[model samples]
Target: MADRVASDHESITTVRATLARRGSTSRPAIELPDEQSSSSPDSASSRRDADAFPAGEVVRLVVDGSERHAKIEEYAGDRSIPGAYDAPSMARDPDSASNRLVEWADDKGLELGQSVLVDVIEEGFKYGVREPGERVFYDATEAPDDSLASIAQQLEDN
Candidate 1:
């Protein structure tokens, strides 16, 4: 446990030192763990995990179809996100707001083959990304006749 704590401390210190040393050409290279340590299996795993999400970054989910669109705003805190999406504009239409997603497999007459798209909402209270599968969008109607809803469910599971 102590060894692990020490490694964590060392990593933090190394990062801070590097950031502070940026733009200074006179300082020697700051090396915490050398190439051998960085290339180790554990170090590689740590790198992958570290790249998961950045703190305080925003993530928007846009589910769209013909003549309709739904968007939600959230912050990428630790993992994917830490809390629920706080979209105030689309809060009225619970059906169109949170439940509806793009029609990937079938249009089911709702989209009428117009197609659907989902993307990260770019600006606050504005339209977000429309590319499919970029974010999670699901429709839970218990019994939905719309083929698009079925495809959206599949997208969510995937």
Candidate 2:
């Protein structure tokens, strides 16, 4: 078996996720629920939000000053949970598909109603986690606009 490797990249965005306790013991300690006004027909049983968190992609989670790899997944869409869209959950591996946030939260002594910062490392692929606080931004170079301009400059000929 090969050991897991880490990737180098900057976070795209950080989300302040408020924690909520799950009703069932079988479920994770918290449910990072995302409720939308409408349903996404294109979304599948997993990777509900491909633009943000892609399933099977590894993410670096910084919990309690420690870093770990986690996979992003969305299970609500599969179960047909109403108003739930792109609700990402972390897993250690593909087989069990369990939420890693639960264990991390327990280790950090985090409770329900608290907020956690989930940083998007590579758009849909990678991400990171930390304590929620002020918003942080990464240094990035903006790509030049390629679209046509609405107003064209008039050319003068001799």
Candidate 3:
């Protein structure tokens, strides 16, 4: 009985240590829209409206040294939800956002790794290389001059 207890204690300690390490290294969760909803007519119409809006911005990121483009409005999560309890809760699953991006890329015949360096190019938002898997939360409050050149410049600096 004592031996079993000791072994269990050791296992618990190892698990705790692993969790702590992951917590420290983990990036913020990326929130992607549900695939099912994205195909609905309502969602499609909304997407068209968003594209027509002047506030729409396009962000470009270098995935494996190649330029990849994604609409800022597509992955920015639902803005309707207020505050911390938003549509894509950052606390849900660390890989959710990254996986979504990877899946999208894969569908386009582009391969992405477990980690990716993202350069966000939305206007009015501070341009920078987002942490791996962080682009899903990318958002902008005001529209700026949308420029693909600026994104390329930021990527060069990184």
Candidate 4:
């Protein structure tokens, strides 16, 4: 392997020169990344297949410090926690909040297609957090104009 550092390249060049002096006609081929993907350093995964989601469902999108937005399913849609959810007894389970929020949203007419930002700690009161709180997002559909992004933008701009 040839290093790109000037010091290493100098040594490799010297060696190749020495081989050429021996009347060797062979040449080593240098390989580089495909030109199409040179823009991104981590490009391999860019070509990988992703899970296909069902169309026409309203999906809740949560955007935070991270660039990615987590999607949560909306009404008629439900996320189930491992134990029975009572909201009053959640702090024991870190993820119990999701089940409770989905339930609460259901009762509040925020059905399957609604997107929401939920305080994981509060929802997990039955399993509340010991320290700070965690925020999770839920989405359940694919309509852009009616998506969380558009709704949030409309809300924010207004």
The all-Cα superposition gives candidate 1 an RMSD in Å to the true structure of 21.0
**Collision pairs in model 2:** none
Cα RMSD of predicted structure 2: 16.2
Candidate 1: tens digits of C-alpha lDDT, residues 46-128: 22222222233332332332223332222232222111123423332333443233232222332222222212121222222
**lDDT value, candidate 1, whole model:** 0.25
Best by TM-score: 2
Clashing pairs in 1: 60-121, 119-129
The weakest ten consecutive residues by lDDT in model 3 span 13-22
Best-to-worst lDDT order: 2, 3, 1, 4
Cα deviation in Å at residue 13, candidate 1? Answer: 35
Off by over 4 Å in 4: 1-84, 87-102, 120-158
Overall local distance difference test of candidate 3: 0.26
lDDT of 2 at 40: 19
lDDT of 4 by residue, 120-149 (tens): 211111111010122222222233443765
When 1 and 2 are scored with TM-score, the better candidate is: 2
Model 2: per-residue lDDT, tens digit, 40-141?
Answer: 111211122445655444444544444444554456542111111122222432344444566666766777677655554445433445554433333332
Off by over 4 Å in 3: 1-55, 74-117, 120-158
Which sections of candidate 2 miss by over 4 Å?
1-12, 26-49, 78-100, 134-158
User: Deviation in angstroms for 86 in model 4?
Assistant: 2.6
